[model samples]
Target chain A: MKRRTALKVAASAALTSVLTIGSAYGAEPIRFGAVAPKTGALAAGAAITHWPNIQLWVHQVNERGGLRMKDGSRRKVEIIEYDDRTNPGETIKAVERLATQDKVDFIVAPYSTGLNVAAAPVFAKLGYPQVAATAITDKIPELTQRYPSIFFALGSTTALASSVADVLAKMKAEGKIGNRIAMVNVADAFGIELAEASRPIFVKAGFEIVFNRSYPLGTQDLSPIVKGAKASNPDAFVAWSYPPDTFALTEQSKIEGLNVKAYYTAVATAFPAYGGKFGKSVEGHLGAGGVNTDTAEMKAYFAAHQKVTGKPADYWASAVTYASLQVLEQSIEAVGTDRKAVIEHISKSTFQTVMGPWKFVNQSIDKVWTVGQWQGGVFHGVASTGLPGAKPVIVKTGW
Target chain B: MTARETRTLILVVVAFALLACLPLLRHGYLLSLGVDIAMYTVLATSWALFSGPTHYISLATAAFYGIGAYVVAAGIGTLPYPALVALAGLAGAVAAALVGLATLRLSGVYFVIFTLGLAELVRQIVTWVQNNFTGSRGMYVLTSITERMIYWELLALAAAVFFIGWRVARSRLGFALRIIGNDETVAAHLGINSAACKLALFVISGAFAGMVGAIMAPRLSYIEPSIAFTSELSFQVVIMALLGGVHRLWGPLVGVIPFTILWEVIAARFPTQTVLLLGIAFLLIVYLIPNGVVGRIESALRAAQRRVSHA
Candidate 1:
């Protein structure tokens, strides 16, 4: 009877010690879910700009001992990711899974405007603060009204269009280019919105629309569009293109000798691969969303990003994406893993990130980095309209 | 009914009963997955309803599907969901009848090319309408319905398609279709009214696909021309049907479930190589089991029975 009592006492002590140690060592991980285009047409861009940044952010946060919770305990981030396949349907399904099935604490936004817009309702319904990193749209007022938890980190479409128009207007005034302008857009939400916004802005700036065309998304051959624009012999060319078509249009333009003093393409024109592919030919080419690479913070961020991810961040949305993650992290650290608290914190606070200080004004970024140009193999901010960094726009040289 | 028929009916009833209880699972991701699988099942089975028995290789699934999606998008606020689904079915049947009237006379590669061209034509027209008339880049449908409800709707649509397919497979229409598939010239010589039968089946098939698209549109919430008219939709349905063995009624169901799960798994695990892996797997399946998993399993079971009977 004594031996039996001692055995029971020893087992109880062992179990107690085990329970205490386990409780002390094992705090539940804060789960962050993301749905990005890991495959399909947008996969290449996502790899460079979206996924790598997320990976880097998660790594850095964990390395720094995770998020400092409001209750004074630290929890490591546990990332749950899904590939949206760059399809809106897939994106919606992924978001639904993240919110309902995985029950992630937070969800990073998908990459593009169309996807972000499509997913806004789902996020709003689930009460997630969707800080969209690459969504550029003109319908901010409507979207904000519908989805109060959604925020656009990228600049608005109107701001982008007006900035480009302003640069062209300045060029026209200086006699660097003629008033005739050629514009072509991909027939999708992102391209269509930009084109619609820019048309009136360009006309108001005294530029005659010499050639205007819209091609379907995922179009393989852009030779006809480039040839048509060249036949018109416009003094400026603007292509509101996605990544694949951006590269295709530039290639076809060079082959067709479609020379214009002011050449601009959207999306992937700021990609490092773009400069690498075009070499010196891409110098003086203009794109959307440029970074002031000379800033010490920007330089360090780029260096660390390359070192960590083993891939170069693009000149445009990569920094924006990383900054959005920073905002989420800051919000989470400030208020713990409670999503409602995170959303409230993000709405009220300003965060200093890779893109400098970011504060939301009515769910849209107050400052916009509108137009960028490739000069001497580097993308420079040629027109930062509502933002600080600005460089003089240079006339694009012939390929 | 024979014992085999009774057993089959009971099994189907029980299967549907279990599927109806899917909402009880209460996993949002699984519900969404069930909805997707149900959508693909409807599409694949409907495609096979005509194309399987006729061997016409219709590539116009996207056209009908896109039309149905657009109809729902256009009538979102004005019409109820059930009403929109019926209208979408009517629209699909009418469109299919028209397309069949024009292209049914053509056979072999010409029919395939015409159907392929039809999808592109419909897509361009929708794009034009969206750009010129609506001036709306995208259409959003506000729905108070839950995902569970959508899953049930899709499940019902899939069950309907399965029932229709099963009935047609046993009826005179299915016999006529098989004969026509085997040899159109011989079927016509036998006074089968091959053209009329083919066109009717085509219309029926399209109606089911359209209903599925209509049901799915509200779930998507936002519809753009590009999303609605993707050729990938047609290709995916065709692949699913072919992968499951188009000749059998349950082949599409078998194909859709596994492929959908595989897709979710591969897409999550290996996002970059999804297409490549899926392509390789498809090629292997085609090489090993040309008639699909159902066909292979059926063949294996028959051989086993024969061996047992001999023993």
Candidate 2:
């Protein structure tokens, strides 16, 4: 009897879920789908950098009575979301499902470089335009050639690597730093690509790489890496790292007192939490991605993002991520919900975004904020690929 | 085979034939889920072939799977797809045989720990090799293999694995392994070559896992050590096998089907809360169905039969 009751309840619960999933919504809202690593090792970072921005975009669009269609009818957004759990297999399956089953009008690309690459084929096959805002790979030319619909907004590994190299070289010329350098990278796709790109560029810039090493991703003990970099006594230190490792490496550097005039780290160094945690000590600390937070456009974007999501946007790719969405929105509005039309429209157009008036040449954004520094409690864009209104780099005189 | 066994075999074939026709429907989502279902079916069923009767509890599924993915990543353009898959299977078998010979001596927890460590070791080796030899840490398997093709490959592999499992369950080797699982010393005393039996089955399991990995690689497109050799996959397979009652030949399927669907639903319904819900769901499954769905059904049937007989 007890078992029968349990069975009855289970059956009804399953039935309800099926109904809810199959239920139609009002207003014929334009369906936007996204598969994010919401429940994995990358979840925490995605929470801050990826998911919140997506929500903010949705909220803003819906508040403005959705996207304006060509017929002047407004279509609100209804999101079909999936937690990828950070598995590539799961990521692929979720994207495929969104494309085929849910049949969403638009699909947002997954977070991080690896996942974006993993699901690119699915996006191509399903005729969805994958706006890969967070993906940073040097294989942009090849990828763009292959997947014509997929757009990479974040600058390439080569672009970023050269920027770091350029920043260090500029400092050396000013006698702020020397030619000797210490470098470490997280041994994953993102870090490895950057490191490989930088090696040739750094050599060409007449800088001797005094120390170079790579630690595996998710490695907890970073003291050895920090100590090793310090032992070389290099004038500049750079770590092409992921979020957790970036924080860990910075903490270890502070603990070990590994002083280098032009210290640079990647990924999470632009995070607001990084600023909140280290406070004044992070002033002049260089990192990946610089934004002119002082710009009125940027100021408004920041305000809207914080107001909607109740979280501050990161200094680097948050705006970039939001900008990719803006590009998608503009394309969709112009071309309607037809996937091919949007892709073609996006390929040949310029978009006014939070990151400024952006254009995709060869389906890739060329200009990007490659290096940023903390100045007066704000991560300011110190250098870029000639993005308008970038600030000058500030030297790290102390911890 | 007995008539009963023949009927079961026919049913299996009919099911396979129906599943083979899924691509014709061209429902992209169903086919995608089919690929997942078939992949896990292959992994869990093949896993049951060795770990079921043997009870060795090997946690090295990802090692063989990663090896298969890497094999495809390394050989995608140069070699034909089928040949790459075959080579991956062979590679997995060879690796398993080597590991089994060395570590199969240690039973229970010791073997589990060693097997868990094996995937990490292989991943590091792959990462090092890629760093030193290949210019990139990750490789792209840029083939025009469609999702339908991947699903079919996995479905065929699942059928082959299940057929092998059925045969192994009724074979002399199966009898010996069951005894070994019960008591290794007693099995040896009973004139069973326990080590050899365990090693043979382990190779078969690893081979299937590797084949599944190779077939699924194109769907992934991007191949890196971390993506290929996620340790979570190993644990998931184990949990699935346990949930379905690994002792039965077709038990893992019962576990895989529901788990995969439930996972999708939970992930969809509660995107942010899914992780917490997943943990809760697993705890509930383990607690409520400790003996597994198959075991519970078998026991209930036995009880009903006894009641009817008494009447």
Candidate 3:
């Protein structure tokens, strides 16, 4: 009697699951593919900005029973992942694998500026919409024209660099700061692009770049650099830096008491640790990447990100990455797995995301935060091309 | 020519014919893998041509490779593709000759250190130039060349490298280099111009590496100092040559195929731990096959012949 009851229970349980799933959505899962630098120089950055966002997007989509189809059927999303080892060759290979070997329905952009640029042609040839979020280069106008299917969410190097100059120029005009400024950059693609783009803009804004030097990316002791910048006695200091160097420079600035009204660093300035470590000191500190975290929706996003990834979403490109996914998901939902149609839809439609309603004009983001400031404990939006919800710039009282 | 040389010539021709048709499958992944193997084969074979006979263990493969790529990137629109490739090869040869003349006096660890530093030194100089002049970090290579085109060019380059290596192995320079590799002082006493022979072979090796780099620049789509002259590439080429056996012209081929497939599998299976797994795999290869698979297999065959004669 006991054996018969157990068998009957298993049959009914299996029958119910099959009936429900078959009735609601009988289509195969849409296989989404992604590549990131899970191991290498950008591994830490990828962990914070790339992989976790992908996971969260996948979870959110599945929570809604995958994407709703055109035929009143729903297909679940199944993700195929690859770690590019932070090598461009590997990135190309992994993307090719996703397109040819695995036959995934879509491919997400690789992380970092160099890598996204490296893998752009592969994505283009394979007919995948390359929505790059973390990549920031000044050559977007040329790149987008060259690769029709590629898109850039992060603003250009010229836009960000000029924005910094404009902000500092406003300070000088207001008599809040002098025309003299000190600048340092880590000698890599990101740092070099920003630093070089800023030079002309700084000159145009009538600012003298008193101390401009570049140290290698992983330089341990920033004392000499700090000493040189301090000797220049500028009213502002800026560092076009990556994460490790950002933290090192900030710590070194604090140690050396390099007092300046406008202190800014790039990349990792949006990281929660920047605030956690510097706390009250980071107030009025300006950096790249900003978010208006006052809204209920933005708060919910932060909560969900923390809950899912066990870390706060970075104030910089993390939202831009997620917003790109939202755009991708919506496009795929409207027009099945047709790559061309999906690209067309994304190119045409306005997407309402955590960052707000926006559309790509000429295959580029219409608006993006050029710079963000640390106000109180949040990374508040201080400037953008759109200028929506931008907070007033605050003066820094030495770290 | 000896029967062995004729056999190797025919076998290399057959291998080239087989590899050139892989892109016909119309599969991106397979074609990319073919590109990987052919690129590595050329790099390792050419590297062994100089380093194997001299036992110099030069790690400047990346330096030449980067020079080749940068040459193409800088001169793409100004010159034709073939011209750029030739110019890249010439540039590499000239650079190699200069470096070899200056640093050939050092040997063993000092030579290794110099060659290893060469890549970084080149990278730094390139960075400084770009920073000061172009106001950009990297340049984009927007060309009509497809992946299939790259694969074919690389395969053709591989064949050319193998043919040159085969000829050099039978040449008088090869004999002198063998003596120099065994004992440089002894070779000098025997009236061998050891320095010139080494420099000649080094130039040839560098030229091949440069051409390969030019062919591969489009695959990366962009060229930067760090990407063009990555240190990992130099070490990877060394590992491939060592694994195949530097003593023979065909040894690096013996190493490149297995390592390429094993790497693809490891990358897929353990994506997050690729570096760690790669370390473990290298350790195993070194421990089990120190003299390389080809050398070990050749020795084993000779031992079997000896046993048969005794019986």
Candidate 4:
């Protein structure tokens, strides 16, 4: 009887100890939901630009004892992801699932501008702060009015267009290139907005658009377009393109020898693969985004990104995405998952990130990293409206 | 009613009753999935209604669906959603009748090619109109209804399509269509107005597809020409109908549910290789079961019953 009573007491003690330990250490993970194009047409780009960055951010955060809460407790991040399949309907459904089904604490934005715009209203309605890292649009005033929680991390269409025009204008003045330019844009929203914005800017800068064209998305053959641009005999070529078209246009340009003094392609030109693909030919090639790899923090980030993701980060939005996550983390840590507090903190506070000191102004990125040119196998910032410390523009070499 | 008819009615009633209670469970993901499944079921079933009966491999589903989506896009604020849905159906019926009058006489591969071309033509036209006239890339739809409401509406549409299918299958029109599918020349000689029957069925199928597209537009909250007119939608509905056994009324329901679940599961688990995996699975299923899942099941059950009778 006495032995039985002792066993019961020991069992009770063990149960109490287990409960205490569980309460102290095993807090529920803060779930972060992300919808990216895991399949369909945009899968290749998403693999490099979207998913890897999120995975790396989560891994790095968990490695450093997770996010610190205001209650002096650390909670690891658990990511719940859905493949948007590069469709707006799928994106909306995925966002709904993330918000209602998974009941996630936070949501990271989808990949492209169209998708981000499609999802913005849903995110706003659901009261989630959407930090759109790759979305480029001129509808900032309207979008902000419609959804205050929506923030644009990428440069606006005007910012990107004007920056490219300024570089071209400088080249024309320096006698590096002529005033005649050829421009082609993808027929989607992103390319359309950029094309429309850049047309007026280029005209104002005294550059004549000798050849202007718009091609549909998922276009397989850019040979005809590149051939047309070459036939125009323009001094510079500008393509507002997505990832696949960017690569295709560059390849076709090389094959067709559509070489110009100023060659610019948007969206994926800052990709490390772009430099790796063309080797020395990529030097002086201008693209959408640029990074100042000279900063100490940038150097460390590059190294860590490679180590963590087992892949080199792209020059364009990789750092930007990581910076957005940094803002989210700092905000969460500062305000402890009180969503209102987190949103308030994100809007008000300046967080140091891999992209250096970052803050949102008027629900949009105040600073723009608009144009980058490949020089010696590295993408270097060439022109920006707000960002300082840009490298001097160099004339592109002939293919 | 006969025992078999009464039993079928009871089963359908029970299934619908169960379906109607689904939203009450408050499974948000399941409700969303149900909406997708119901939309596909409507598409597949409606396609089967015409293509299965007439043996006309119509690839014009996207054309009608896109037309309906555009109707909603152009008239979202001008009329009520239910009225827009009906208008979309009317528009689809009219378009299908016009196309049917033009091409219903063509047979076999010619009919297939014409319908495929028709879809592409409509897609290009919509794209052009959207780019030039709309001055908008995509239109935003304003909807205050819940997902559950959308699901119920889709479910009701699917049920209505099923009822219409049942009524048609039992009518003299259904007899003529079956005969026409078997041998068009023989059916014509039997005093059946083959052209009229085919045109009517085609219009009905197109109208149902249009209704689905209209109802689904607001749920998406945005519609663009590319999204609305994608050939993938047409191809998916065809594949689902074929995979479920186009001959049976419940075949599409059987095919769509499993296919959607599999797609969602595979897509979520293997995002990079989803297309590859789905392709492999599709090939295996088509090769293994040429008549589809429902057809194979029916064959197996009949074989077993025959064996028992012989015993």
DockQ per candidate? 0.33, 0.53, 0.50, 0.30
Instruction: List, residue by residue over B273-307, the lDDT tens digit for candidate 3.
Output: 78899999899988999999898999999999999
lDDT string, candidate 2, A1-399, tens digits:
999999999999999996675455445788899998877777887888899889999999989988998888888888878989888778888887788777788989899887998888878878899999998887788888888779999988778889999999999999888999999998876777788889889999999999999998789999999999999999999999988898999899999999889889998999999999988889889999978898788999999988988989999889989999999899988989999999999999999999889999899999899999999999998788888787777778777
Q: Which digits, one per residue and each the tens of the lDDT, describe model 2 over residues B45-76?
A: 89988998888898999999999998998888
TM-score of A-chain in each prediction? Answer: 0.89, 0.92, 0.92, 0.90
Where does the lowest 10-residue lDDT sum fall in candidate 3 chain B?
Answer: B129-138
Q: Please give, for residues B1-311, the per-residue lDDT of candidate 1 as tens digits.
A: 79999999899889989998987987667777888898898899999899888989888898898889888888987988889999999999999999999989899899989988887888777766655455454466656667788788888887888888888888999899899999998998999999999999999988887787788776666676667777878888887888898888888888888889988887766656777888887787778878888898899999999999999
State each model's C-alpha RMSD to the native: 6.6, 3.1, 4.9, 6.4
Winner on lDDT (1 vs 3):
3
True interface contacts reproduced, per candidate = 0.39, 0.64, 0.63, 0.27
Runs of candidate 3 exceeding 4 Å displacement: A1-26, B1-8
Clash pairs for candidate 2: A290-A381, A291-A381
Best by DockQ: 2
lDDT of 2 at A48: 88
Model 2 reaches what TM-score against the true structure? 0.93
lDDT of 4 by residue, A1-399 (tens): 999999999999999996675466577678899998887667788888888889999998889888988898889888878888788767877887788867899999888776887787678767788889887776777777777788888877788889999999999998889999999988765676677778889999999999998788779999999999999999999999988899999999999999798999998999999888889988889999998888898889889889988999999888898888888999999998777677778888888888878888888877868899998878988887677778998887777
Candidate 3 reaches a DockQ of: 0.50
Model 4 chain B: ten consecutive residues of lowest lDDT:
B129-138
Model 4 complex DockQ against the native: 0.30
